[model samples]
Target: MSASPAPKSYAPWLLMLPALVMVVVFFGIPMAYMLRMSFNLHVDEKFYVPGFTFEHYAQLFANPLFTAAIWTTIKLAFAAALATVVIGYCFALIAWLKPPRWRFLLVGLALCPLLISEVAIIFGWWMFFPKNGLLSYALVSSGLITSKFSLMYTEFAAFVGLIYITLPYCFFIMLSVFDGIDKRTLEASADLGAGPFQTFVEVLLPLSRAGLAVAFSQAFIWAIGTYATPSALGPDTLWTVGYLIQDQMLNKHNWPMASAFSMILVAGVAVVMAVTRSFMAKRQAVHV
Candidate 1:
């Protein structure tokens, strides 16, 4: 024979078959189970009853508490994400402009937080905010205050925690984006008599708009899903969708209700990501 038979084009798909199976087994099966459970009936004594009903979805809107929690979660997440992106952008820009040694130092500091566990981070913040904590002691030692004061169990404390945890991810993302940009453009802008602020607004901002969108979406998703830090640090009034799901599953033993809430949370996040990506794509198209 002049040549052996050629291999099939579908060989690559055969190689991918195990990964596809794993994805369906791990993700798809659980998702289907949760979806089916969401419509099941729930009894006070039992975890769930095997009857389909739309009562849970109806109750989601009917209950003012759940509605309030949804709004509160969205509000805090957006605010925290916006703050994180702004701070991260500035941090990344400074790091980008630094010399090589300083650049590495700044990057090392940014990465330090990621090595620590979220629980430990929250506990550290918890200890720092109470009346008898490090912050109060520092203020008193510095003669800034006559007595110890507490920021514990406040929305501000919770917001700070949210930002602290999400900052590293945002910073690294922006840093990578900045690294891809040519250094010559900034120098050229300065040569053209553009002020620092003007250069940032006209050149840097336009170049990094897509990265900003990505970082915001990432931070927002993280903030919304994190319940432990906020609940532990914040006031009792702060109830998020995450807290609701936890309460339903563990405290209330209402699996159906928890499943319903979980479904809604998943749907909400999916919709947000879809909208954000679509809007950014349209903006990019317009710019081009």
Candidate 2:
């Protein structure tokens, strides 16, 4: 009998067809249309009309409000990502070092932020930061302050909210990295007369560097794309890229401008991801 024919290689692409179609329909088409409209007309503020001009793009950069918003967004994202990495690293280390029975519980707590809805989290902070909220109540009850004090509508609140929202994701990512590492490496370092700080700096940190980078990037990306928590918890001046997009589309009824803003945000995120992946790749190559 003749040998059986080899199996076809079309299976993977066939499986991916639906996702490919969804991506094209949802992402590609919308982006193309938005790009086209970015060069279109404002049409007396009533509607947009097709035109070929760079005036909109020019005006976007010319506007100081937009420029300041972009700066605020960058700062908030950087701060949040740094904070998340530090806090998540500690939390994940705790989870990793704990007994098996408590490990799951600790991880569950760290991941709770991701599981909760963004709106719910915002509401929780909204209640907690106000003059009549938990902080004020506690301080007043303990006589720490004669009058209620609130951190609401401040940059600090925004930072707290951003960190809280992104911490779980970073924690989970770092936790997985910590899990992959052998604890005996740390023990070995200690056995050789390395102190706790020295072992961490030499062994644990080196091994975990890639993970830390990944977590920071993840948190930063999320923080950059988020608008709700910042707007709700932060002061009126706390404008960000996502908030700008929302403003242009909804409040200003400027879809093309909103689309333009979105494209810029996407470009920013792509650059960050590219840079981070490049760093990770270089590190892996060096290690290998």
Candidate 3:
């Protein structure tokens, strides 16, 4: 007789036990709490009574400030995402075509913004845009302007800061996509008498459409959540949903409203992610 064979089991599940517990304890619990809080009624300045109510969500649409913030955030995010994609595509394409030595240098430069803290980046730009900052001083010193002029606290400043923060992500995403393309394809296009612009439009752009969609979605998602850079660099009137969430949670001590805003923001991001996934899936199916 032979020894009984060992029983088969899901031993691999043991490895995931800790991660499952952490997710439930951290993310799951907090999300459940926030969902409950979003329905509670606010009483006076400090207290919120437990209850089921839709007033918080209703007020979000009813209030002009919140409505305006929604529009502003979407517009800013879309603009920033589009600009980042265009510039990053150009930068990535150039870097991709360059020698290996130059590619490494360009990649390192692009990663600089990503490595630095957002607060640090905001402060650096803050100092660079003020009337007495490097930019104004340079223009004045160079006799390009009769008087120093600040670019600070303007829409242009906000857009610049947003683009700076989001550009590195777009660059890396597009670079990886560009790297996957065969160099011989471009050569073949050139052999067939295609100009540089023609090759890019006919060969490169079509191949990279999926990557462009992915990069744009990621950049837009990032921009939608970023409030610090824009708030610090742009004018006072530029209020984003993130800023409003902070204000409600800290300044006004309105937990219910804050929770509502956070839930809505999360929902918006989820919708964008779903759409992106569907788009990519369709593209993959078509290719197959």
Candidate 4:
């Protein structure tokens, strides 16, 4: 006959205290520092000066190299994100519809790329795409080509690397989304004479809109910030904002410029996330 304990007003905040502290300490402080630093001056090859100036931010558009880098990053990220989503959707759907005995194996394979560091993964692809590497050897052994073929230092190579890294994120996200879907709805679609592709377009895509949007946004963000894989796998013409940021900070020893580029990157990521949330909300409303 005892009354249930009343819910504490501060309980939810108490549970979130650690995460709030982490966000403030780690993300908030660094962003603030970077924002302040972006306005500082860089004088005579010195790391930075404490004086305020708008030159760093202004050069973002005035400088042709920076403009090209920004555009290249956008194009590369868009292509990579689209490719990752399509491939991940197909793979995840196949895995989802497979027998339970095979699901574990497919999931394990999807997770294999994530277990390795990006640097290690890039190195493996580096070897594979080179003239004397396994891919060339296989092609030669199969008599497909008389001479060795090299894909290294190509946009295709860079695109492949970008897709490889982002695919797992998309796969897992879509898989979880698929898991929450009602199987009977899919069966109903089939019973109503909808073909596989028709059902995918009408039912699967609509049901998984939220997850697809999130996965695409995440992939786009990651692809835009890609620094090493493109530098390693793609041609010198392929320049990204990340490459410029590193060059400005370390090579040019220009902290202000680096911070300015970083602010732009952060802004782009924020916009993508906002769009994703909005898109998801709209989708939810429509479905409801």
TM-score of each: 0.91, 0.92, 0.91, 0.95
Q: Candidate 3: where is the Cα deviation over 4 Å?
A: 1-25
Error of 4 at 283 (Å): 1.1
Worst 10 residues of 3 by lDDT: 4-13
Regions more than 4 Å wrong, model 4: 1-7
Each prediction's Cα lDDT score? Answer: 0.92, 0.89, 0.92, 0.94
In candidate 3, residue 243 scores what lDDT? 87
- Name the best candidate (by lDDT): 4
Ranking by lDDT: 4, 3, 1, 2
Give the Å error, residue 190, model 3: 0.8
Kindly list the per-residue Cα lDDT of model 1 for residues 68-108, writing each as its tens digit: 99899989999999999999999999999999999999999
RMSD of each: 3.2, 2.8, 3.5, 3.0
- Give the number of the best model, judged by TM-score: 4
User: Candidate 4: worst 10 consecutive residues by lDDT?
Assistant: 3-12
Q: Which digits, one per residue and each the tens of the lDDT, describe model 4 over residues 1-288?
A: 997766797799889999999999999999999999999999999999999999998999999999999999999999999999999988998899999978999999999999999999999997899999999999999999999989999999999999999999999999999999998898999999999889989998888888989999989999998899998899988889988998998999999999999999999999999999999889888878
Clashes in model 3: which pairs? none
> Residues 143-253, candidate 2, lDDT per residue (tens digit)?
988998889999999999999999998988998999899999988998999999999999999999999989999999999999898999989888888888888888888
